[model samples]
Target: MEAIATQDRITSKAERLRILEQTLIGAGDKGVRPSEIARRLGVRRQTVYRDLRALSNAHVPLWNPGRGRWAVLQDQYVGTVRLTIHEAVALFFAARLLVRMADEFNPHAVSALEKLSLRFPEPVRTQARQAARQMEGSPRNREFVQALESLTLGWIERRKVRVLYRSAEGRAAHPYVLHPYFLEPIAPGLAAYVLGYEETYFRSIVTLKIERMTGARLLDERFEEPANFDPAAVLQNAWGIMGSPDPVTVRLRFTPDVTRRVKESHWHPSQHIEDTPDGGCILTLRVGHTLELVPWIRSWGRSCEVLEPAPLREQLGAEYRAAAALYHAG
Candidate 1:
């Protein structure tokens, strides 16, 4: 990539004098247009006129207008500037993402940026700072950030590390690392989840809860993997990031009063909806795994009915009865 032209590094007057002399000496190049120079160089029209006049003063035959056309008398281009608005925005975001992700690893650079004012123009600097501030606490998730940072580094280094993690059912274990592919932002905004292969399961990209991670490193040696390890394909179809091979086809019914509530939100991608004859709605959700969705399913109370997946229906019924038994035992 060619360097972007900026006033950041301006040439000496002596170098400018040499270029002007060369323009005067060269016959092919003539008449640097003020407007073209200003547009291409990213500066005011007056700045271009000033440079042209500076050249002309030194015996260079540079002209602003001649025969309704203007061209640069100089054969050499100092540089070029061609940053569109879209590119500028993208660069701004990329920088902020880097700063947020790399703050602890390179604290010196981050501190330097914060202490001294940005070298860019005031408006651009202000906008960038505002964008950074917007990301600072938008998630309100500072509790797991440090742990995430360490895990992220371990993933990049391809080393085994131990983590005291609480499972979905709240079981604790020291999960050893096999390999880390990537992290993903699961929710539209705020939340992030680390999806990586675990040594315990050998190549399964287990979905671990970032919030439940206890960043305690273990004394165990680094783990290894063979060349022929294959990751489970069932993860792609898993609902809510729970990868389970034994999936179920689930169906739900919404009463007339709660029909609008059921249709308003998208629970899953493959959800099917049908309008009922009694002005109600039938919501069918096919979950590849129904383990984590138990609480969510039961929250609907009498409004939702489990119409398929005999096992899930049985599980929910047992759970409901067990809860009722809590009061009976009391």
Candidate 2:
């Protein structure tokens, strides 16, 4: 197939740079001719020669190996960035994380890394790439990625969106109209959620999981972000992603078995720990209603107990009874 018209392909300065880098790196020892570079760039051969000369003058390691052919020396690039080992390792892992979470790994990130590695100091690049591979995980399905991209566009354009979503309860998918405002990243996924106004429920701000959105489309209508909307303030006391509008002060007592572990980690922004007699500890948190905390408390089993909030305690009792009944039935 004929290559895309170079003018159509190189739409931006960044694209031109990427193409030049790719061509130079691909032409290892054989060295590419100026005419070939001109054909690829949709420019005249003279223009290519001028650019090459300018690059050489700028101390870019471009050299003519032989026979009117030009090539970039291996591991030598113009304006190559030098990153500390720690910085390189961090970026490598971050790229791997984005790749793992994206349906198709971001092409720009992959391309940038490839370009950087071409000039990175020998063994460090190899080591960082290896470590990154070990950090990679499976990406989401294609449809989920598409939905996420659509939602992101809506958020950026200040447009409303309609979404077909499947809940964690395994119920049939339902449609929702939302005014997407922000995207927040949660655990188990590298992608963030679309936090927005649920139009069906007026004045309610809800968090929508992008992965659960089976379908999404942006509406023509635009929205004004709420003047009082402050994401940080809204989520200041949240235990997890979703929290109650009216938070409660919760007190829980943990037995000595897990106090050390519990104290070592900062569970929430409002969490406070007080040492109790008999080597136990009391954990206090001013947080949203206790719906999301149930699983966390239950995970501790008999070692933990909710000391306050009668309603939450009652809910837990009911859940335990339901569990007992299910086990007894078998």
Candidate 3:
């Protein structure tokens, strides 16, 4: 019982500190009264005052007017980095996953996100929290991550590194000079992924999962990339970050029941939405043949219709038919 009470006290203290920081940070140099803090945090005014006192004792750079209001100390407020709604949400979740991927990725990113709780408007913060929950994060591969960091660092420094890699086809293990062009984070575990080409294999951008790197060895070979090497444009036509030279314009129609809900959120940057007279909504996306969009499209079940893109529609139609055949067979 005593230990439980102590734990509760610690939890309460942390909660109060969070309330205190959020109250002051969002105040924007304006002072906040205890009543306001209590109202926002759903606590008593006295509790708010107590939390304020605790914050002051912690040297949080807060000052009380002595009349029962606390304001952040002048010249002590470090302005937070301003972020748009999508940017904050994306950054928060991405940073969180990155930190979890490589243990040494960035310890301070979580702290920064914690600070951003106060930085964002309440609605944006809430929405971002919800958005963060929607991501599909893979398990952290720590051993794979460490090897990636070592090799990527060596590669960027113009040092050649031999990497033992397993291809996606699971055919054979090969050693080649890995040039890490970009880091892609698939899930919560890997900090970021390294993309480069292999000297022993195809010169195309081979994606090396940061968490799957088995071994890395640094070599003494240095060569500068082409002057017009534009990393951003490298995968211009790629679908869902996996760029390919060929892209298709895929069109989909959502059933009346699902159209409104679908319209409430932005599915893709290249999305175009049109409402049908009867009620259904048409969504078209210009993307590569990368299969990333399949899961989202499949989630709607019979409610979604693939319209303009014959290939996508055929693919989905085949899958649905196959599933139906299985049911009938069973």
Candidate 4:
């Protein structure tokens, strides 16, 4: 009986260590407190501390961020990849772009940059590390991170997720069960959105901003993406991330002063340019909606004119008049 009890203790210790490691990894940058770890493992705080020490001695990159919280340095645990000099430089550039795009602190991005920097040489390595540090300085939005994680899990596993979402209009957050199909990053990359099927209320595919999700939880049930659903095709007519079922033809004339500037870049795949006799140009394209195009057209100021879509032209005219009124007021 004594030998059997000893064997049981050994088995329990082994199992506890395995569970402990998983908990630390899942904790990410937030880490877990020793007390929380103890509670989870049904052990004493001292025992938890001892286990953490044992794991550290075994070469796990465990990090402690005050208040007795412990976490795993995930970048250190992942496998290594060898990259050529040109590839490393390209990766470094991509990492910098990500840093510039993010508006909030994202630990995973920081970790990725740190890991990539380790493989780079000299000045490039230093630059990558600097970019990671800059990203670390951004404000931490814990709720946003949690929502993103839940949605990511659902999307990868084809599981349904319940999220409390609020729209840009500042409406009250409402719950919905969603079948996440794709995650898309808006151009210039300041924000990310998920396009999914709303199973509970809308019963339609909707695009939701990740930052607007107040809460999210993965459901037990799974789903399969629609056979005919193609994200790229769906968004092909989109001016930005939002797409419309019915596309409209848009025509814009750029003054000669800015026609050369516009012709320098291919704005859209559906665009066709026609040079006018007056040295100006008319660009035509079919887009889902003109809502997103409004801002871009406004950016060109007087150099641009909306020739087709009378409603859009009138809308911009009213906006311009309102702005003029503000400036012209005594």
Highest TM-score against the true fold, candidate: 4
The lDDT leader among the candidates is 4
lDDT of 1 by residue, 92-123 (tens): 66656655554223332343344322443556
What C-alpha lDDT do the candidate models reach, one value each? Answer: 0.59, 0.74, 0.66, 0.89
Candidate 2 local lDDT, 1-330, one digit each (tens): 245565564465345555665687788978899888889998888767767766666566877789998888774453446688677767766655555555433333455666556545667577545534433333426676577667777888888888888877978988888898888766433445777898875558888788788768878989888988888887777776666668898999999988898989988888889999978899998887677678789989878888888888888878889999999998
Off by over 4 Å in 2: 1-84, 88-140, 166-174, 188-192, 200-204, 318-330
What does each candidate score in C-alpha RMSD?
14.6, 11.7, 12.9, 11.9
Candidate order by TM-score, decreasing, is 4, 2, 3, 1
Each prediction's TM-score versus the true structure: 0.49, 0.62, 0.57, 0.73
lDDT head-to-head 1 vs 2, winner: 2
After superposing all C-alphas onto the true structure, candidate 3 shows an RMSD in angstroms of 12.9
Note the residue pairs that clash in candidate 1: 31-71, 32-71, 32-72
User: What tens digits encode model 4's per-residue C-alpha lDDT throughout 1-330?
Assistant: 999999999999978988998899988988999999899888999999999998888677899866779999885674235799999998988887888888988888898899789899999999899999999999999988888888888988899999898888967999999999999877543898999999888999999899888778989999989999999998999878878779999999999999999999999888999999999999998999888899899999999999989999999899999999999995
Clashes of each: 3, 0, 8, 0
Per-residue lDDT of model 3, residues 188-249, tens digit only: 23234666766667766566655445777667776565567565675554445565556778
- lDDT of model number 3: 0.66
